[model samples]
Target: MQHAIHPAYGPVVFRDKAADFAFLTRSTLGSDRTVEWEDGRTYPVVDVEISSASHPFHTGTARVLDAAGRVERFEWRYGREAA
Candidate 1:
């Protein structure tokens, strides 16, 4: 691997604020923010909108999509006759 071209991969933290969850892992990403881990080490922290901890699929709280309603909406938007 080229030293200059390759990104610096190291330990980082991904935080889900909504669920108050966080985890440390290694990644190429970096952040100005930092947090102290349970292991008594500081790591770059990245705030995420969603993660497996708070994801609907992982938590089994996913909502069923209204497929028929979406079709109707599309038809109405395009002025197409609904069969």
Candidate 2:
């Protein structure tokens, strides 16, 4: 909590463009972008690629990993001799 030593901690908007999602939270991160929120207040907007709203795992859209297929591919490439 030393003065002038730490980055400013304040409200920042994280925007997920793909899902059209945004949320306000306090953090040390920031961006040059700005956005007016529902409350009619402008906040620093940070664009993100994914968030809980768009993430496959969080939204139940996740694809099952093909573990067996990967194992077979690895075996094929390296052979069983590669223990």
Task: Tell me each candidate's TM-score.
Answer: 0.76, 0.80
Predicted candidate 1 versus true structure: per-residue lDDT over 1-83, tens digit per residue: 55699889999999999999999899999999899999998999999999998999999999999999999999788888557
Q: After superposition, which runs of candidate 2 have C-alpha atoms over 4 Å from their true positions?
A: 72-79
* Shift of residue 27 alpha carbon in model 1, Å: 0.5
User: Per-residue lDDT for 64 in model 1?
Assistant: 97
Model 2 scores what on Cα lDDT? Answer: 0.93
For candidate 2, the 10 contiguous residues with the lowest summed lDDT are 74-83
Q: Candidate 1 overall Cα lDDT vs. reference? A: 0.94
6-71 per-residue lDDT for model 2 (tens digits)? 998899999999999999999999898899999999999999898999999999989998999999
The per-model lDDT (C-alpha) reads 0.94, 0.93
In model 2, residue pairs whose N, Cα or C atoms come closer than 3 Å (at least 3 residues apart or on different chains), thus clashing, are: none
Error of 1 at 51 (Å): 0.7
